[model samples]
Target: MTRTIRLRFFASVREAVGIAQEELALPDEVRTVGQVRSLLVARGGVWADALAEGRALRMAYNQQMTGADTPVGEGGEVAFFPPVTGG
Candidate 1:
């Protein structure tokens, strides 16, 4: 089954991806947030670099912080951003 997800990019991630938000439909194999990242990375170029493995990117599903292994579902909203830092 396909899952329709709303993707949100923030801060530097937004700058790198060059979009604030968009809707994506995932293939059944793309079940986890990390898989979604992989799909995007497969696009190559900036996407591959910005969300590449080992990068210090943060993820959120439905406004709550999430990990790579978290399962994604229908109508879910996922966000990606760099780790927050405060002085």
Candidate 2:
């Protein structure tokens, strides 16, 4: 089944992805924050480069800082941002 989640991007991630937030419907295989990220990454191009695994990306689920493995479901929220930001 497919489900939807709110996606929030911050700092460099926002700059790179060129969006602050969005609502994305996910496939059944995408049940975790990591998988959500992977879904975006699969978009290729900037989505892949901006969210590349080689980068130090931080993830959150429902506003609580979490690892990519954190589970996500319909109407849940996920956030992505860099580890550090400039003043």
TM-score of each: 0.97, 0.92
* lDDT per residue as tens, model 2, 1-87: 779899999988999989999999888888889888888999999999999888899999999999988999889999999897669
The residue-by-residue lDDT of candidate 1 on 1-87, one tens digit each, is 667999999999999989999999999899999999999999999999999999999999999999999999999999999999999
| Runs in model 2 lying further than 4 Å from the true structure | 85-87
**Which clashing pairs does model 2 show?**
none
Candidate topping TM-score: 1
- Please give the clash total of every predicted structure, in order: 0, 0
**RMSD in angstroms between candidate 1 and the native structure over all alpha carbons:** 0.7
TM-score of 1: 0.97
lDDT for position 8 in model 2: 98
